[model samples]
Target: MLDLIIRQGRVDDEGPLADIGVRDGRIDQVAPAVREEARRELHAGGKVVIPGLIEPHIHPDKAFLEQKMPNRSGTLEEAIRNTAALKARYTAEDVRERAERVLEWAVRRGTTTLRAHPDVDPIEKLMGVEALLALRQAYADVLDLQIVAFPQEGIIKAPGTEELMREAIRLGADAVGGCPYNEAGITETRRHIDICFRLAAQHGLPIDMHVDFADDVDDPRYTTAEYIARKTIAEGYQGRVSLGHVTTLGAVAPEARASLFELLAQAGISIVMLPATDLHLSGRKDRRTVRRGLAPAKELLAAGVNVAISSNNIRNAFTPFGLADMLQIGLLLCHTAHMGSPGEQMAVLRMATVNAARAIGIGDVYGLAAGRQADLLVLDTERVADVLVDQPDRLYVVKRGQVTVTTHRTVEVHRGPGTRSGERPAAGPSRQADRIREGGVPR
Candidate 1:
């Protein structure tokens, strides 16, 4: 017997209809039919089943820190300053409460895994890091949270930031983070990168950074991220480095952009695009023909560099919107980048699922297939295009073989073609079997 069985659902990647059976928190069987009874059966006759989505970049710490002093001005610098002001008053309990709320929203929206960055500024007493670590422990079963010890306020520009980053890593942070462009100078930025690499190698953690979010074209210090990528590859740490929000790369000259792309691709550095935050934080100074200020997603994808999109900050100091929905982000990408073709849409879908998983170094533990954990979502849609266009409600969310959230679909009654005298259609196997044989549609 199985713990749960999803009946007649269309599997992702355009596969045939099958019943997915789960037992002991793993996908036990996926076939045309399962004879054994199940404790619970979800009827998904006209729906689609897909693997749970993963968001690789987010700021749960900023969510907690910005509760009191929200960003009024929409500029990136104003958001940073406001967050700094708010971080001064943060406490462990306060951070935990607010971060928990954001995680709950993520869970309800079909995101089971996330990589959240926590601020490591020393003057704020590292309250953001402390709060996220505590919350990660508290919600271990429901969510797989990886905390990035991020120096949001530049690693070298802020006082004692390097020591605080080390302190956060020692406290069980999963990765090392930095903002190279925001540092004082190229030398300082290179110093910060060296510190991150040293800590990551010593602790066996990954490196994720807010690389370059500015749009200044003449700045030479913007190339520190490429330097870090090259050094990481030379030291034999390929695929363990990720660059977040490289917006300035989009604003650089064509020759410079090509060179940067070549270096990143050769160094195996993944790029993360934050659509929600970039739209809000960038291009504030341009009066006419404002730039999108986002990284070149299409170009990066074409160059064989792994690129993924994220929600970044949700109702936090950076942006007061963003609701943890990557589908919405995908739609925005389609509009902003003019990726309206069928193949391009499929690529973006993969970005939200497979590519994001690879960005955070958790691809093996994800996806919908045999030998994988039974974490899946059943949506009330027939095809991938329909799911993205309609944004239907999730009918069932199965996590580790248990039904985490289930919403029933309402059925309506209709008169048969040849009904007579208040008599209903036959309800025996003959009628049911005939309907099945004829491939009857669900009511």
Candidate 2:
């Protein structure tokens, strides 16, 4: 017998409705009618069924540190300095507690796979990595957590960080991470990238880095995008390197930017745009008409470069707000990136689902197709096109074919006596005389 069957679900905006059958933690069949019997059944009720959201880049270790230390200057420099002070007091228990809260929030919000870049510098030491390792095992059934030994501090300038990074890998870090822009100068930054590539080579792990995060690459240190691109091509590491927060591309000269796009596409590198943190921390120096410090998402997509969006930090010094919600972040991108059109909106959705899956190297087994791992979500919206516009609730979240999260909300709108027009009531019913009882949500 099948494990589960989700009935009458809309899988595409223009296609007919489909039913998905799950067996042995994998999708067995997806057709208009799943005829086989199942142990359990979920009624989508004509809602949209989509692949679970993937967070290609996120910082679970540093989440919710905004109140502890605030960045009054509202600059990347100050955010790092403020977070460093808090990191000094971190314990495994403390990190795990905060990370667990964020992970739970992410799962409820329909994130099935998350790539967490936990800081591995001297201040936090290995506390973040250790804490996340435990979380990986704890949430393995419901979430896929990929840990990166991220050196938020400069690898070359921060002494002994190299040893700490190697130790983090030995302790089970999934990928090698770098922050070349945080180094002392251009030379040290280049060395930082070299060290990261060398480490990944030694351990046979993928590479993700925080590269060129400034509003503009006026400083030589922030001009390492081309270098990293060439290095990826030379090392034959295509499709394995991911870069986060390269907002400088938005400010680069158009002609030069176009060339860089081609190079990135050629090297098969993925650019993960952290819109929440990027829009917050970038362009601090602009005095008039501040620029949107986001990566050139539209231009990059036209060049056939892989682009994805993520929440880099949550309620932290870097970004003061987040609910660990991918749709909220995607909607923000839709607004700031001028992607309000229907086609643009669909592209934004793909950035969160398909592009993100490829970014973290999980595309092979991570979609809604038959024989793929059954990680899907049934949203509380009927049409796939309205998924973003409606910001619908994830009524059901399935991971490995097992139901993980289910949300049920009920609302009743009661109109007062002699209500005119089709307008909604300004206030809910306050007195029994004006109240009307109804079941389910008001249409």
Candidate 3:
């Protein structure tokens, strides 16, 4: 007997049909046949079953303030000003309510885990972390919420922030974070990052930073990514650090990019690309050629660095649009980063699922293989390729051997001339399945 069984599902719209068995909140077997009795069974009906998504970067404290105070110009500076004003008036109840709305949507969109960055400077006074901590515990059964004590306003620039960040970790934040570019200069920015490193080491937690989010990446002083990569190696925190919104990595001088990518790979650091927010808030000053504000994903991937995508904000000033969907983020990445081929599509999906998990050090415990946690999404589509274009039904979402969310899709062609909505005649598998080869539905 098993806790639950998922019947006749495909991994990525390819390969032979297989069944997944779950017992004790973990995947027990994944094979062509698993004839086992269980407390519950989900008839996948040939839908694609994927591991639950992970959100690597977000600001739960400043989510959904699009209408409260608007940034007329979608520039980064204006966003910071607008959000600072909003954060000043932030209450625990308000933050909790907004963060809950975003988290609920993310969960419904197939995210089982997320890393939320809440402001921890003196102005916010740890209110954001406190609210998210409470919400984390409340949603523990369904969502794994990890909070980052982020100094969004800068530490040296806003003296006394280091102390608050220390308190934030003591209050249950899982990681240390910083926005060093918000400081006075690159010199102070280095100190800002050093302070975060010291804190992460002090509290024994991972570090996630917001670095080098500029439209143009040429700087005579220094780029934050290079300094941070060097620091990761110096502090012996390789593989334990992630950088979010490093758009400058994409904009840097072409000659400089390769060296920086090699340095990042050497340090075993991960990059979380915020497509929605970065695309919106960047290049305000460029009228001739608008900047795309994206990292060099292809170059980074080729350099053997772990590059992931994330929904950074939900309807906030930083990003006036988002629904907490990693697929949506990945779709935007596919367009902006020119990842249109079938192999690229699989890589894009992995950015949201596997790479995001590795960013937070949860890859070993997450995924669809045997012995991994049973966090899966049975999407309602003939093949996995439709997941991005069709927004297909989320037939079932199983978390840890238990079903958490489920839905179905129904359509009809009304028997019109040459209409073909129903399954094809005498189909062992749809002809469309022919295109779905090597774990993909080829274009």
Among the numbered candidates, top TM-score falls to 2
Ten residues in a row with the worst lDDT in model 1? Answer: 434-443
TM-scores for all predictions: 0.87, 0.94, 0.93
What do the candidate models score in CA lDDT, each in turn? 0.77, 0.90, 0.85
**Per-residue C-alpha lDDT of model 1 across residues 58-173, encoded as one tens digit per residue:** 88766744556777677887888887777777777777787778788777777778899878886565787788888788766667789898887877788888788888888889
Superposed on all Cα atoms, the candidates' RMSDs to the truth, in angstroms, are 6.9, 6.9, 3.1
The CA lDDT at 104 in model 3 is 88
Q: Candidate 2 has what TM-score? A: 0.94
Better of 1 and 3 by lDDT: 3
Local distance difference test, candidate 3 = 0.85
Model 3: per-residue Cα lDDT over 207-270, one tens digit each: 9998888877565222688888998999999999999988888777788778889999999999
TM-score, prediction 1:
0.87
- For candidate 2, give the lDDT of residue 332: 98
Q: Which stretches of candidate 3 lie over 4 Å from their true place?
A: 219-222, 409-443
User: Model 2, 396-441: lDDT tens per residue?
Assistant: 9999999999998977666778866466648754433112211101
